[model samples]
Target: MKYQARLSLDVLFKFIFKITGLLVLLLLGGILTMLVYNSFSFFLDVKPLDFITGLAWNPTGSSPTFGMLPLILSTTLVTIGAMLLAIPIGIGTATFISEYASPGVKNILKPAIEILAAIPSVVIGFLGIVVLSPGLANLSNLPNGLNALNGAILLAVMALPTIITVAEDAIHAVPKSYKEASYAVGGTKWQTVYKVSIPAAAPGIIAAVMLGVGRAIGETMTVLMATGNASMMPTGFFDSVKTMTATIAIEMGEVPYQTTHYYALYAIATVLFFMTLLANLLGEFFINRFRKYHAA
Candidate 1:
């Protein structure tokens, strides 16, 4: 009787999990469908070039411009900036927690780092506006303190915990046997870490950083709050900028649904969706390749 009941519970759990997976897929499809439906009218009027190449974004002006170069440039610049900031710090922090931290220290610090992950995006944005934006704008070279640089820095901070936590987990996942074998061969601790452990963990570290890229690309509130929303292509790091996500958040409220500007936002959204999708795809690809290589 006990065995039969256990089997029934197992079957029930499997059925529930299958249903849950379907629901998640259905939700995603609904979103894609809605975006496509909303974007049809706008696509009919503007050539892809208008959004891709045209300059200026004053959609309400008599000579309205929907060119998205400025927004795209901002997103690219900010993401790159954040990546530059995140990579070294995140990897270093991960290495410390996983490789060097004492148990007691890690117990405290891990939770603290994870806390950054839980903080609301709005709160982060508020910090950028109240603190970072003003401070950055005060730089002698920066035309506006609130520029791409500050927004990127904030985004990097937001992305760090994700990168650190995941990479730390990856480093932790390394087998003790591997370290033992390295020492058996007279490998120094740093040599074991840099060569055997890190190479083994490289795929996972890459996966973690890729996730950060997606997060950076999709971030809206922080970018909106910190980046001075100028719609022009950038000349340097300190230039005022606008990102696709920032543009959507700032303008979606006032723009009518059927106008060219409305569609422009959707188009920008589509571009963002593709950017995130590409990041995920690349991550998956590398992860699979690494898995196969590791297996071999």
Candidate 2:
């Protein structure tokens, strides 16, 4: 009787887990469907090509325009800048933590890095306003400190913890036997790390970087606060620009509900959702490819 009861409970748990997974998928599908429906509604009134290629984004004036090119360019520039700034610093810190740090140093530093990830994005945005923006203004002689450069710097700082943590784990996961063999062949510590461990962990490192890119690009408040929120073509690193996220965040509340402007925000959200999804899919592809290669 007890054995039968235990078997019944096991089946019940399995059924619950299955339902949980299905529910998550259903929720995601529901969200995607809603976004598509609303965005399609907006497209009925506005041509898709015009929306895609438009350089202006005045949605409230007498002659309101909805060109998203500037917003897209701004978002792209900041993401690229953040990734460029963060990748080296993140990977280097990860490598040091995994390979070079003494046990005592590692113990102290790992938690410190993790704590950085816990810091609020709003706080980071405020810091950008207080500390980073003023410095950039001084360095560049720009009238205002807030610009793409400021936003990129803030996003890079926010992304660093995730990249460092994930890359460190990947580096640490490199098979001890690989390192042993490299050293057995008389390779120096640096050579073994650079040539063997890092090579072996390349897929994971790439995935980590992609994930960091997703985080940097999707960030809203920090970019909104620091990037001057200009709806213009970005001319340089110092140029003020507005990202899709910031546009949505800033306008979603003030716009009349169910208006064309409201639907446009959903369209922007749809783009963001797909961008993050693509990044995650790319990361998964690398991870799976690495697994297959390792198994082979």
Candidate 3:
């Protein structure tokens, strides 16, 4: 009787899990459908090539161009810059916490680092505006610090906690037997970490970095508040630029219903969604390669 009851419960739970998964897929499909439906009007008026390749984004002028190259470039620049800045620091911190720290120190440090993720994005943006911006402006001799660099710095800060926490968990999950084998071979702790532990954890670390990239790319408030919101082609990190997310947030409310400009915003979102999806796919590809190589 007890065995039959257990089997029934298992079937029920499986059904619930399948329904939950289906719901998530439906939600994602609904969003994509909405974006495509709304943006259809914009594409009818503008050539897809012209919209993607054009440099201008003037939607209010008499001519009213809808080029998206500038926004795409800005988002790419900020995300790349943030990843470059965050990757080393986050991985190194994770290594330290996982491999070197005493239990007491790890306990305190892990919680402190996790607390950083709890801080509101708006507050981080405010700090960028008041603190980091001025300092960067002074250092670079720029008129103001609100630029791609400032946004990258803030995004890096926001991405750090995620990268560090996930990477630390991956590093920690390395089997004790692996380290023991390294010790038996007279390998130093540092040697084992770089040679064995890091290699073993590569898949997880890659996933963590990709998550950080997603966080950096999808962030709206921080970039909007600190990126100077210039819709020009950026020549360097010092130049002020506007990202796709910022563009959508700023214009979506003010745009007229069903107008070309409004539809263009949806188009931008569609592009952004594909970009994020591509990043995740690439991350998965790399992770699979690493896993296969290690297994071999």
Q: Pick the candidate with the highest TM-score.
A: 3
lDDT of 1 by residue, 1-296 (tens): 99999999999999999999999999988877777666666778878777778777788888887887878888999999999999899998999999989999999999999899999988998898888776777774554578888888999999999999999999999999999999999999899999888888989999999989999999988888888888888877788899999889889999987788888788888778877888899999988898888899
Candidate 1: regions farther than 4 A off = none
Order of models, best lDDT first: 3, 2, 1
Clashes of 2: 0
Report the error of model 2 at residue 159, Å: 0.5
Q: What is candidate 2's lDDT per residue for 26-106, written digit by digit as tens?
A: 999999999999999899888888987998999998998998889989999999999999999999999999999999999
> What does candidate 3's lDDT look like per residue over 186-277, in tens digits?
99999999999999999999999999999999999999999999999988899999999999999999999988898999999999999999
lDDT of each: 0.87, 0.92, 0.96
For model 3, the stretches where C-alpha displacement exceeds 4 angstroms are: none
Cα-based TM-score, every candidate: 0.94, 0.95, 0.99
